[model samples]
Target: MTTSTAPLPDSFDPDTRRVPPLGGFNATMLGIELRRTLRNRRTIIFTLVFPIALFLAFGGQEEWNTTVGRGNVAAYVMVSMAFYGAALTAASAGAMVAVERAQGWSRQLRLTPLSPTAYILTKALLALTLGALAIGVVNIAGVAQGRPSMDVGTWIASAVLTLICTLVFAALGVFVGYLVPSENAMQILGPGLALFAFLGNVFIPITQGSLMWHIASFTPMFGVAEISRSVLTGDLPWYAVLNAVAWLGIFVAGAAWRMSRDTARV
Candidate 1:
């Protein structure tokens, strides 16, 4: 009688290892987070209420003007408000994630079949969707008003620009969340992000032809706002687009690494 024993090639080979199914895992987590976030009235107010309120507040201003056609005070304020709204949503996602970590919630998630990569993906999708919806609503509401008119191209370009701006903020939020303790997340993130908005031309003009303007233009916050403003007003800034993407890429990569390391999953 002859007996043969062999190792399991498929099971033991790291080179051929199959990554966990991310799409389903990410989708499921996103769905759950959405439902949970929507149920919280605070989130609804921040995403929809404050931006709309700002639109109303600035819709009547006459001092504002942009190069874009019929781009009056109302349109300028509304667009900038939308940028702020979207940025806040991204920042909040990071803060919320931090809170979850502080409370040991992320640990609970880790114990599930969902891998660390899937968990990170879930946070990213939720943050992006929140940014899009928050900005979209504000923009639509502003347009509904008797704001200035822009060509269809300008409007679409503005939307794309605003999203690009929100991109870095989302990663920034994650970075902040990883660094801050749970109790401090709320206080630290809220004011810090808001200050950035103010400095970035969301609440007011950062002053063209000035040093501050030049500085703000290069900032991630300004990158999104400035590019969108240029595009929305028929100023297609190819250079600005590339620069903004670069800044976003660096910040996001750093933040992702930070989160993974904090979770001990890097």
Candidate 2:
């Protein structure tokens, strides 16, 4: 009699799970994102041109080459340019959410079999693919500059990190798009990303050889850029790993919280 009643189950149906068909959903969203990105000439350029332009402009001259110093410029351009993926995806995808909300896209999706979780996953997946494509192009351009010590494994790891970064930023984009006017997304997100890239080690070394560079060392972009370069060069800085993980956790929590708040808007 003492054990007649058991604790309530964690969920209504403990034996069943409700995880989304993330793989298929991700694939579907990726295909959609690719088509959307390709349709826009500007997106194509940002994903491909900017990195190569910077590489050619800076990676070519002997003075700039020497200034690129110890093969750092090639790596910096390669790594820093990956941020464009996050930037572009965040700008478009975030605004798209707001547009969809206003046009009742969410209502259509909700009425169908598409679960809310699946919908969110789709957005994140689209951002991840765009991130990969943008960053992958940058890396390919990098290969033209110098072989360095990079291998398939290095590139693979970098891609994984870049995708994670994209998803995290996409979440933030979701929140920002929800909060700000859809029209202003480009102005807000574009400049924010540019500033991050500049302050971080994208264009130059984070070590900047100055104590005033303290800000870069502590930023999210710095963590991303440092880890990206380290992984590509087979250096693997432990501190960058810790920093990235810490930022990922904080970013994820904040984004999720913000996303939940927007549920009412739709």
Candidate 3:
């Protein structure tokens, strides 16, 4: 004879089960991500050193002593280098998802309770943390060099804007990571960012309203570069802000779309 199953309890409700907002993203996952990133020596060194080197190379020029806006050109260069470092670091941090995806780690994550939103959010926070570190190191280097001359208020504001603007690149990194194979992700991103930097006027100052300047205005890095320098120049054009907001929205949407596609495959 077969045994019969017991009846369901009155209090039991399957519909009551629900995932938390942001897929239950919290401090623990963020801490784990931060620790893992800190363990990568090459990333640490590259993010910290490269910008400082660039700053020292170009920011110390005697001609840069010419005063512009609220500070000298040396200060301007320093801010640019800081912004560059932050963007590079933030993008690299976000692109790390490619490595995890390549190793089948993302597939494994699908078995867990964690949602893609949580994973992406954790990575974004990690990117911001690393970006801030890059910004701080570059600014400290500028201070030690004593060539950069800007008021304390301008220094603080510029740094804050630089860090905030890096979120656009963080999203870009995530989108690129999902779009390309792991080995090729950084290969394309690294040089692509450098090119963006040049075209965006991060390396060389293009005169406002010039052909190159107009072209640079549409590039991803242009918004961040202009915003970061805005405090010193005492100008924050509406178009520059629009450029940044538009790119940020595009990249973030792209990342979410790609992440959905990736998870669907699993």
Best by lDDT: 3
Expressed as tens digits, the lDDT of each residue in 1-266 for candidate 1 is 24365645776878776656652375555888989877868678778888888777866666545444436556667677888888888778756777788778878877766776677677777878888888889878966875655666666767777776786777878877877777576578677767767767777766676988777666666667766677556564665677678878877787778766775431
Which candidate number has the best TM-score? Answer: 3
Error of 2 at 177 (Å): 1.8
- The candidate with the higher lDDT, 2 or 3, is 3
lDDT of 2 by residue, 1-266 (tens): 77688856757765665655552365665676568757877656655676567655645544433323234444445555665555555446645666666666766766666666777777766667666777777667767667332355656676576656655566656766666644465567667766776776666554555774776766666676666566555565676677677766776676567656665644
Clashing pairs in 1: none
Pitting candidate 1 against candidate 2, the one with the higher TM-score is: 1
- Where does candidate 1 have its weakest 10-residue lDDT segment? 64-73
TM-score of each prediction: 0.81, 0.73, 0.90
lDDT tens digits, residue span 100-200, model 3: 88888889888877887688778888989999999999999999988889899999999999999999999999999899976578788889999999988
Can you tell me which runs of candidate 3 are displaced by over 4 Å? Answer: 1-22, 264-266
Report the number of clashing residue pairs per model.
Answer: 0, 0, 0
Candidate 2 overall lDDT versus native? 0.61
Clashing pairs in 2: none
Candidate 3 versus the native: TM-score? 0.90
Error of 3 at 102 (Å): 1.0
RMSD of 3: 3.3
lDDT score for candidate 3 against the true structure: 0.87
Off by over 4 Å in 2: 1-30, 61-72, 83-91, 144-160, 208-211, 233-239, 263-266
